[model samples]
Target: MPSTSHTAPITADLVRGALDLEPTANGILPHRLPARARARNTDGQLAMAESQPSGVRLVFRTRATAVELDTLPTKRVYIGAPPRPDGQYDLLVDGRPAGRATATGGNTLTIDMSTGAVEHTTGPAGTLRFTGLPERDKTVEIWLPHNETTELVALRTDAPVEPAPASGRRTWLHHGSSISHGSDAASPTTTWPALAAARGGVELVNLGFGGSALLDPFVARTMRDTPADLISVKLGINLVNADLMRLRAFTPAVHGFLDTVREGHPTAPLLVVSPILCPIHEDTPGPTAYDFSRLGEGRLLFTAAGDPGERAEGKLTLGVIRDELKRIVTQRAADDPNVHYLDGRDLYGEADHAELPLPDRLHPDAAAHRRIGERFAAHAFAAEDGPFAQAEE
Candidate 1:
């Protein structure tokens, strides 16, 4: 364990990329969305997702060989599935992986959709320790858990620390669903978007919300207002799994979303990515349902509940969404050449699925996140004739 020999308070100024921070009784809780937007958002799911700090981190420069951060993370507990492990804190030294740790003891929110019952219980905050560094002055980053809502209580190190030096990389703003939210990823630094951003040498502003990327106007507006050099939105699976809207509503919603974004970034490279191959929702319309049979075994999987015949009635399937997204981007590109589209399958298709199956039957596993991130970097960030062709320099 790292020694808490030299302690320093972690103030709001030390956090980077968080839109807002609320002072808590013990410390501070970082928020990815502003309070005004949060006030306007009535959806509990959206509120929780936005407050989870997907791309937020504590960044600093230090000469210490050991460090510790005390935090209270609010972790979710699902009734049907086994409890998720404590959220991971990723440590990076001079832009490279150093170590990973998880804080112990925090509140728990146990939800039971089967009965519409909810329970909340509190626990003690714990420390995340990282020891044995190079002992030279270096930039260090501690990426907060993307899946847990954490309240930072304190920071301790063997030496004083300051904010990290800026990398000056182009900022990449990306939005998507749970897959983009780092679900099942080992840590915040390894999410597909995080991996892709690291490989492409871009700063990340992630808007990935677990089961909550519904092409909301506020989300689009938020992306518009945020300063980003490269932008991408991964769409489809959430729509299919949630069965949120039919094709008629979904089409206009997408247009509205893009229209809102382009209002602020008129000429920036914008990429629209369709969903990857989720065989369960490929040809079938959905309202994906839980596979209760595996629940007792401590494995949870989802199956498309909507019928294939519903597609003719304008119900959405991943295939339909992909075709529509491609068509929309292509049509708009006739006038707006900076806007482009990439098939999600290009990042992770049927062949890749056979090799790296989605453990939850929907969200990709950690290894799959790595694969998708690498592929996305290759196809979108490095390929010639792509929107980010000049970004390679």
Candidate 2:
């Protein structure tokens, strides 16, 4: 059986009706459905209406200060997650904040913009509704308060939109730090992941979290669990800047993370990417500092020095770590046939650095993003025998 229960139609009317329920005087509703709505739960699963052409189900993980949702006309937005009272999220349609919803520390909050009803619940799910979406493609921006950290777990449209044919395309799973997460990228679409995915003609799952891609085991587990035909892990820079772990732990941790991923994607083509040339960290271990006050003065500077007494304990420099990554991957390739390596320096080197330096001397600017994307696509995808090589017809 194809599971008819899972195939139940999800309709706008059902969504509208759900939103139509009035909140009590206390401005709260049951997070779980009423017993009656539960009766309609097909096999203990909440049935979402089948996606319509005008609606889509966009699902991915994001850790960003701002996020945008792209959808069609007549689309609505629904969210289900544990609420954080101290954390507030702004929902922007197009470029302006369309609605502001607060997290009440409840299990869920449902916003029915169609009825102008904002409902809070304690059970386990939340919804945000936007009626009268523009007929053409629309972008919903979720801007997090500065320095606030959050993840976007899922996004979907109400209607069934056709997925582009996947017949000949390869999938790419890329992991990196803030830059990869689209930090300071002019727009979401201009982010390197989006740009690279578009250029390579491949599906992409971006696990780039701003300030959180610290070779965490949980992240490695997440990557291990994801399905993909191609995988690349960008390491360094953040580790150096944050000075989170010393070399002893950092090297093994990197190996462990890669090991975990390889366990799940044994034969999948894996590319381990080292950090690009960073002069500040090129010779010294850095707990880099910035003077935000000097931003308007057009004078941003970073100071780097070897940690006193910790230098021989092996604090990692960009140069040292890059060599270690190359050695590690080269050694692993002795037994793993599909594993490969990319020196991030190859993407942007000292020469390129001199020509198009990063504004922060840390993260690249928009122009640098385009340059890196182009180089990545050429080296990683355009190569005929590379991981993203097109399949035979």
lDDT of 1: 0.88
Reference-based TM-score of each model: 0.96, 0.61
Cα-based lDDT for every prediction: 0.88, 0.56
Instruction: Look at candidate 1 and give me any clashing residue pairs.
Output: none
Best by TM-score: 1
Model 2 C-alpha lDDT per residue in residues 1-393, reported as the tens digit of each score? 111111112222222101112234323221112334334434211211111100011221212223222211111223322221233344545444455543322233355423545554443223333334344444444433211222222234443222222335576777786677655455444566666776887756566655555786756776687778889999987788778788789878988999999889998889888887778788778676653445356544455645644657788778878988889988999999788888988888988899989776777777787788888888888898765666577
Per-residue alpha-carbon lDDT of model 1 for 250-332, expressed as tens digits?
98999999999999999999999999899999999889898877877889888889999999999999999999999999989
> Model 1, poorest ten-residue lDDT window?
384-393
Model 1 residue runs over 4 Å out of place are: 1-5, 391-393
